[model samples]
Target: DHGSQYVSDVFQDEIAFLGIKSSPSYVREPQGNGIAERFVRTLKENLLWVRHFDTVEELRLALLEFKETYNREWIVGRHGYKTPAQVRKEQTAPVSIAA
Candidate 1:
């Protein structure tokens, strides 16, 4: 779930230390990485292309704001027009089953 940098010893060691299982993307299959691709496209269109950042810190702050807005406001068509925040709420909500 990372770029070519994941092949580095530091990256591999960090993930191993964190006990995170790495699932490498499929070779020659762009569709397998569609979600990440779409996110990058969205980020570029919404933040990178529209704004000018004088510093890396400024860009980082803008990205955090953009992430919050996207999760709270953006309607995801694939999720029945639910924002990511809504989907997360539903997923984490307690479920009750009555007999």
Candidate 2:
């Protein structure tokens, strides 16, 4: 997240392509954004602070791996102890009709 900058058209297009929603923050209240802020903190603690990367490419790849790990293994309390990957799977599961 870039702070308070005009988001680029290309970036918006990419977000739409990836089916990600942009949640706009409320004005002048940092507390209202606690969940996202906590995630940034968690990401830094789990991935960024644990190693020194020699290059941007290395860091990018590491981040991708970290993301996969987080989705597969991280248990979120709000998700009833399920990983993010599990939640996504449940959300996308097909509905069966009773015959």
Largest TM-score belongs to which candidate?
1
Go through the candidates in order and give the C-alpha RMSD of each one to the true structure: 4.0, 4.6
Q: What TM-score against the true fold does each predicted structure earn?
A: 0.74, 0.70
Q: How close is candidate 2 to the true structure, as a TM-score?
A: 0.70
* Residue pairs of candidate 2 with colliding backbone atoms: none
Best by lDDT: 1
User: Which parts of model 1 are misplaced by more than 4 Å?
Assistant: 1-8, 14-32
Q: Give lDDT tens digits, candidate 1, residues 1-99.
A: 456698888988999999998778777767658977898999999889999999999998999999999999999998799999999999999999998
Each model's C-alpha lDDT?
Answer: 0.90, 0.85
Per-residue CA lDDT of candidate 2, range 1-99, in tens? Answer: 446352777777788798998776666767657877788899999889999999999999999999999899999987899999999999999999999
Please identify model 2 stretches exceeding 4 Å from their true place.
1-32
